[model samples]
Target chain A: MDIAYFPGCSLHAMAHEYDTSTRLVCQRLGINLYEVPDWNCCGATAAHSLDHHLSVGLSSRNLALVKDMNLKQMTTPCAGCFNRLKTASVELKQNDDLTAEIEKLAGISLTGAKEVEVAHTLQVIMEAVGMEGIKEQVIKPLNGMKLAAYSGCLITRPRAIAQFDDPEQPVALDHLLQALGAQPVHWSHKAECCGGGFAASDTDIVVDLGGQVLEAARQAGAEAIVAACPMCQTNLDTRQRAIEDERGIKYNLPIVYFTQLMGLAFSYSPRQMGLNRLLTSPTTLLRSRGLS
Target chain B: MSADFYKPMRLNEIDSSLQEEIKKVCDINVELCMECGKCTGGCSNAHIFDYTPRKIVQLVKLGAEKTLLSMDALWTCVSCQLCVDRCPSQINIPHIMDYIREKAHRQGVKTRRINVELFHDLMLNSIRKTGRVAEAPLMLNFNLRSRQYMKDAVLGGRMFLKGKLSPFSPVVKDIDHVRRLFKKIADNREG
Candidate 1:
């Protein structure tokens, strides 16, 4: 199960924990992740917001690199990057004019680029390592830790671009948590927005929307929130205290990456999964469940 | 409140160029929208948007270019795609938002939320320089430029202690390729 990996910008810096856990879990699952060499940023919300051609061109450059790696599939841990790369790959394959334009703008030949498939890291794990396969490797079950599976936007969004899982009501993360012996609570804001790129530009939006997600997770009695996207994890974890201060309520729920939980279930240490990097600590919750 | 509220719009005089442009650029037909408020109902940021998703679509059909380009919704939209997914006609409001936003940016329309566009520009400048975004430096510059210097100072210190803030920025091996792509796109947009 060899696949090309694009950790994106956040994985290298803010979401380094996601990168660590993803690599560790993938290795344990016998999945070889060959990183796309010298990949550029996916342009994210910026490029797409300002210029559509630049957005497609940026991801097309990475797609071209994947073809050069001779890999048929690529996976990214960041949902934003996955969305941009997947959208580019889909558009490049479907629209000849787009392929030609992207080739001209990016200076990369898309001769066999149509063969390259883009998928989120969660999709890779679910497809390559099935529920039975994951359960077989769970040396340390979650001990019934209640978790809110926060798929966030971009992972299962726009339907046409992501092309995996339900956009409105995603359950892949919940199913994965169930395979790990964790109880995934039913929450309203599971697939809601966490103000994404607005975290830096406008803090109010994150405070408002992220507050809704945290409140929903807490109301559902989740011990912790599980996230697959770096932005969502960052927003929910970092801005939680601010949200609490604003709403006059306390939500001490830690936002953990799905990969981190998978690593824990696979008997990896908390340090190995970079669990301490989270702002809202999950140590207490994990300890209470006797799974730390 | 005003006489304009009771005045009927001259349907034949309404401009359709913006609608045509949207169809040409995004391949989304504004006319397909049945004025269902499902988009606004499920919108994550509709509460903050000056013009809701349904109204934005209506404005597109009405060819309200000035309103569409200058609305605060252009800056506040989270691009969650919930509106498009929930739309009976799949109008792609997010894409429409993007198209209008890009146009607004090009026209240099005054954004109601200036910091949002500023942050985006800063991120793009970082990419233009390093071929990748350096989160630590980018955030610092954003704080400095946006005059919100103390915005995340506490979080920064905590993250720094945890070794989350890397000082070194990542530069791609072949930087010229990225610069060339950026230059070409800018030139294309201008020409």
Candidate 2:
């Protein structure tokens, strides 16, 4: 019924559309999202790269805050944040000293640390709002639009930490897209890295990796790419033109949030879901399909 | 995926302290790596990294701290963990890479692919000040600082036009606590 939500840094800014759509979609499902009070950065790729303690501290702090909210279930839409939070939870269970230290900082003992569990929004959607629950609520069937469901790196990698879906070949996002009447395209590089964390400083890597994913989707004849993480959406949407220019190919692929597509199926307005915020501009594809 | 580097490493010159630090931080049994390049072969960013996953662990086990810390290989690892999943030894290659990155960042080693280090610091600086990242300014500042202006300028312009680049990024009320949290952790005051 109620769950602690940690949108992380991206959802509030570059990924605000993701947050908007996720919130609206969750609301339609009668789910309440109590955002973790005073949630800080998850200390993503940067924090962990700089200091292990800081990364753990940053992520574990949010988990501790979720406990403060009297909730054991925590969810984040960002794959990066989800992985960091899940890592903290899984690591805390491994080392008693680290758990004790985190407890000391949180002012709670190990026994009292109410088994905080972290879930990506994809898993949350799949488990909390099953396919049947979702199918019943769809007003727009998506009219069988072809889309590539991209889960990105962190959602289903490092097997032990993120055990939600298969690391190599995840079909949860594909299944959800299918439930909404969208044809989930079968692409080999669907679960590949999007060079998400390196988008800014190392744009080249992001270009290469993101380009590869987009190229694969294009090869599979996908009209758009559906992603559960903001970073994947950012990379897929922001760098498409450049990849096209460099590779001498044409892929006018519109990268969209899974929730944004869900919002469309739920008959939410474009403005309500921040649909216009997508950098790649889904106008043509959505217009062609009579979606928006 | 250019495999053009040929640097021979001798096993006789291992530094115990560095090995201990890497082992302690990463919590990996590097000795179990059977020279199986599966980790390196499975790496997504090995094309961009100088020290591939298996080589990173091999270097850490060899205690080649100077060589490992000198390159920007650590930052290139997006932590996809494909290597870890494929490793028969189950070596936590990404964690080891994270350890190397933490060390590189601490030592302030600036070398090839150094822009990634700038990116990491700028992101941390943004987060430390705002409690969350302001992407527009973060990207702008990162590009300006790293001199990568031409890469995403047009894309950013389009994003701004689309209303994706928000000018106002909220700073958490507990800004002081965030500042302290970062400071204490960086100063090695916390576990």
Candidate 3:
């Protein structure tokens, strides 16, 4: 199966490991990911916060590029990019005024833009490779390693835009973990916000909210937290020490991308999955489980 | 309840222009709200917000545009969309928050959380310049502009060691197309 992929800005830089693992895992799953050529930034929180039209227009340009690619579907690894692109696709199809304005701004005729469907990479994996299919490819079972499936906010949010999984209680990640032979622990902060896009702007918000997420996962007896979004992984992993320092509690939980875990289950080496890139190293935890 | 809760509010005297504007722009009817605090209850940042989602809707109904635009909630809202999804009426509080925040930005209203706005501007500036955001340089510029050079310094070192921080910024081949969109938005806002 071939799908247009938009790695977004984070995947190229701060979340390079996510990009590497996503490509490797998708290759193993027999999914061909054709990157959308010359795709621009999705304008994320900044565009949406200041100018709604610009936000839609920025994403519309990318959607137009996907339309040009002649691909019916486009998928992104970043939840923030997925939200923006999906929102733009939904809005342009429904609101003719927006479609017209975006065409004028983007200087491209979005004739078949509505035909392009935007989905998160997780949705792609779940739909293209079913639970049974994933179970069949598990060369190395997770050895009952407990994990907290952290969906963050944008993956399955607002109910209308994402249009996949439950916004309140998302279980797709949990189900995927189960298929990988990992024990997905019941956690309260599964779909909670990780203070996204605020890690640079306001560090305190991430520390406060991310602290709660970490504490919830730790309380649920999760050996590690599996995240699908780069922002969530970055916030939870990088600021963990700060969160510990502020809350005066020890939480040495490593935040790993779900793709990384899938790669591990596919018998890929830790270095192949870029596991060493994680701030809170999962080496000790994985070694304990004998899965690494 | 506070004694102010019992104070009779003259419905005829209250200006509903803000609510009217929201409906006009986003088609979200704040009047459809039944005063259910479920939005605030599930809100991710309500504890940190000066005006919760429920209160922001009420402010719109009362035509408290000044307060709505200048409130710290405008800057602090995480846009998690929990409030909108949980609302029985499905009032898009995040959309309203975005609309009001944009208005505040256009008017140059003084935000208590200046760094938040500054970071946003820097990100936009990066996109406008290169058609894509370079995380490494963007973070550097944010730290420099916010005057906290030491912020995220340790994390930066770790990321650099992990080969995450790329020194070269990625630029789109068709940069003119992206800039035109930014210029058009600016022109529209001005006109």
Candidate 4:
């Protein structure tokens, strides 16, 4: 279960919780996460927008680095990084001409690491730690803790590229939540865009679209929302207050990363799961229910 | 990356007057258009707009100002950014759309239903405070403004009943950075 890990930029800074929780949960689940040697940014949102070839070239350099490491697989925690790497890999794998051009530009050669899977942390968890194992591991079992799973656009979109799950309706996270003995509420906007990078340049659309997803989750009776992407976490949990103020209604739902919840159900403390980093406290609810 | 993939079915070039205005706003070279139509295909509003991505680029290239601005199609974009994400040419069609829509708004050419513009105001207001988009409050404001609050009244009440939406503001870590960014964008618009 050992794999090369790329934490990307945000995981070390703003999303320290995701980084810490990922390490801790992998430890508990008997999986190994070795940081990719001297890894760099995946050229996530910015590189892709500014120049197509430059973005692919930059991503190819990272991939070529991994290929040089001789690693067969790499697991990424951030959804953006995952998408970037996978997109580049898909392009390189499918378009030989593109690979040759990018290699020329990047000054590196990719030996086409066959089936060298580039996967999100969630997919790795789902595959390595099956639902049955997860259910058995649940010491706290978020019992009756209603949750709406937000599977934003990246991991599931541009259908031809990612193919992680269903494009329109994804249920991988939902299935995982239900197996963990919690109620996973149904919502239609699960696959909607969270306006990731646009949040910086176009704030208005980000809130408006993100709000719709949150509202739908709320309507479906979720006590909190679970997401795999940190951007979604930032939008739903951190910016939730402004959404409230702008519209003059309250949405106090706790936003938790899937791994954090896994850590909790596996008998880990808030400290172990980095729950303190969250703006909305779900730990208190867990403690009140005598689970923490 | 094949530039020939999107052959414009109609309106290969825009009118000159509209071209100058669009170029002034976008300021980026629309001539680098590669004719990819990725923008049109991924646009969330394309379903509602007559100008597909190919058509929009064609219009911009031909400088079709009167037709582009006069149409209500520009206002329907949610700006979710799918087109921007997929565009191989790296053209920010949404930004172009925004500039066009803003121009239309200034000229008093608006929709009978102003959902996108209203959403924009609420969204910007939310981001100014939190540095990100918050859902519950934005929805409430959007619903209230659109006078469709009753549509999701039960859901809203249920959320309140379950403490999903709260009255207290959540802590934002970098309020100043957010304020500065918002102000800079706003100032740029006015100038």
Candidate 5:
């Protein structure tokens, strides 16, 4: 199946691995991701809080761009971008007056644009790609590997917007892990917030609050935490050091996007999954078990 | 846990017009509070607040505006959306807390440290100027405001090196269009 893709800003910059690996994995899964030409920033958390209309306007511009491309479904790898795009789509659909107002503001009509569907990279993999297909492609199944899934607030929350899974306790990632032949650790803080942009804007809160999710994952016996969003990956992976210092506890959990795990399951090499970008490498762990 | 554990600040003890505005906006149904302690149990920051979420909601239900105004619990919410997410009665407890905090600001109840107020000023100032946030200015302004000017020095400098974080705020094309819409919202809200 073919879908329009909007990678958003972070995927190009910080989460390049997610972008590349998703593309490669999608190719392996017989899915085509055509970029929405001239796509702009999704206005993420910044625009949403400051100017409500501008946030919707920015996201609508991208949605309209995808609609203009004649693709009804636009897949975004970043959870935050997906949330912003999906929420804006719902808002525009529900409030026509506001939609018209925003369309006029942008000088483009969203009238008759195909109903654009926004979904994360995971939804396409689990639902569209199918577990049986993944099981067939597993050159290296992560057998007996205990992993925890950490889905921060952006992907699951504001449940009215992204109705992909149960917001309170989602098992999409865990189910995907099992399909790849890995054990998913059970934990309660799956839908918790990793302080979002607060990690960059506010260090103290990130340390205190981000630590809670990490501890929950660790206590649940997860060797590594798997995530789909770039921000969540950066927070849990990049900021693990700060959390350890602040809390005086060693949490050497590896943060891997589900695509990287999928890449491995598809029999693709770690290099192809961009596994080298990880702060905590899964090479030693995967190799120790002769899987890598 | 203990009876004396929660000591709410008395609103009547502190007279402030800002508090009155807060009370007006919150419009919390003070009488409906069951003191069931659900909000307190679900709150992520109950440990930080002298008054738990249940106490705050109860205070609002009781029209204990002044006491609610002075409590630190009003500012502690991270806006995680969990309290409202789990509220069986579906109370918008966090929005009420934000409203109360805005009132506290008008009444000169502020963070003892300028560091935390840095975010408030940056977010509001950015919104006030553009009716939209410009990420470049927001981060630069935050760094300047918080005196963490050196914190993002290497990384931000690298971003500048890569031509990412430009020195100027990004102008969303035809921002006047958005300004007018914001004006309409303001007008309707006032009406």
Candidate 6:
């Protein structure tokens, strides 16, 4: 399947592994990712706080760009970007005045009301590729590697905008993990808030909230947590030391993007999937299981 | 022994106009909140927030504008929207929080959580100039502006060493168009 892609900011820098893995897995699965031309920031978490029309205008610019492409669909790996784009689409479609104002501000007519269908990569993989299709393409099963799927907020909240997922207890990530021959551990915080976009400003809240998610995943006996959102990845993977210091326990849990694990199951090397670039190394565990 | 007598003690500072503005701007039906406390119960940052999600709603409904605007809760709200998902009332707590924060920021209310606001503003400016954020410079700028020097020093070092921090800002093609968009937004110069 061919689709326009928006990598967001994280995929370019902090979460490049997610981007590379996404590319690798998509290649293996026969999916085409045509990046949206000259995409700007989706105005996540920031613009809405500053001005509502600004957020809608900024995010809808990408939608307008994609609409100009005559592309019926666009996919994003970052939950923040996905949420902003989806929100803008919903807002633009619902409010004719809003749509007119933003379109005029952006100097481009938005086709979001017509043909644009925004989706996250996990949705595309599970729904478009199908579990059986993914299972068939798995050259190397994950050997039952325990993975706790973490679906942070923005992807499923308010249910109306995201329009999919079991908002409280999402299972799409679990389904994708299972298809890759990984064990999807039963965990409650799969759809919990991860103190997103706060890691930079309020580090304490992220450490505390991220600690809860990691500890819960750990208590569920998950070897590692998998996330679709870069905010979740950075919060969980980047600050384990602080969480450990605060909680007085060692949680050496590595957070991997779902696409990276899928790439591993599909026989893509660590280098190819950019797994080696992870802050918290997945090497030792993969090597221990002779999967590396 | 009705609760109304006791309520006035805590809710004496009500401004009805604030409630009307919040409803108009944030689109939150604060009146729909049944005082279930489910939003507070599910709030991930409740411990940090001066007023938890349910209290914020109640306060807004009661028009506790000064309390809502002056306090750190408006700034500390992480905007995760768990309250929105779980709220039977369908109150978009995060959007309301954003609305309150925006209002407060515009009113020049100094907050204990100023760093969060600074970070958000910095992000907007960064995007305005660079088109996309360069992790290294963005973090450096955030640290410098927030005045909490080197908070992520060790992390930044490790990330730079690992090539995660791109020294050069990525300016997208047709960046002039992006600049024009920013100018339009900043000046309300378009449409």
Winning model by DockQ: 3
Ranking by DockQ: 3, 1, 2, 6, 5, 4
How much TM-score does chain B earn in each model?
0.95, 0.85, 0.94, 0.65, 0.67, 0.85
**Model 6 regions lying over 4 Å from their true place:** A111-114, B1-15, B188-191
Interface RMSD of 4: 11.2
Q: Best by lDDT, which number?
A: 3
lDDT string, candidate 1, A168-216, tens digits: 7998999999999999999899899999999989999999999999999
Q: Which pairs of residues have clashing backbones in candidate 1?
A: none
TM-score quality measure for candidate 3: 0.98
lDDT of 4 by residue, A101-197 (tens): 6655444566654336688888888889879878877888878778888888777765555667775578889988887778888887787776675
Superior by TM-score: candidate 2 or candidate 3? 3
TM-scores for every candidate against the unseen true structure: 0.98, 0.93, 0.98, 0.66, 0.77, 0.94
CA lDDT, every prediction? Answer: 0.91, 0.81, 0.92, 0.68, 0.71, 0.82
What is the C-alpha DockQ of each candidate? 0.84, 0.65, 0.85, 0.05, 0.16, 0.63
Better of 3 and 6 by DockQ: 3
Docking class of 1: high
Alpha-carbon deviation at A124 in model 2, angstroms? 1.0
Q: After superposition, how far is residue A219 of candidate 5 from its true place, in Å?
A: 1.9
lDDT of 6 by residue, A1-292 (tens): 8899999988988788888899878878888999998898998888888777778877877887887777889999999999999988888877788888777766777754335889988888888888999999988899888989998887777688888788888988999889888889998799887778888888888888898998899999999999999989888878888899899989898888999888888888877887777788889879866678
User: TM-score of candidate 4's chain B against its reference?
Assistant: 0.65
Off by over 4 Å in 2: A101-114, B1-20, B148-151, B189-191
Q: For model 3, how does the per-residue alpha-carbon lDDT over B1-191 read when each residue is reduced to its tens digit?
A: 13443568888888978888889989999989999799999999999888878988888999978788789998999999899999999999999999999999999999889999999999999999999999989999999988998998888999899888887788999999999999988888788
Clashes of each: 0, 0, 0, 20, 5, 0
Computed on C-alpha atoms, the DockQ of candidate 6 is 0.63
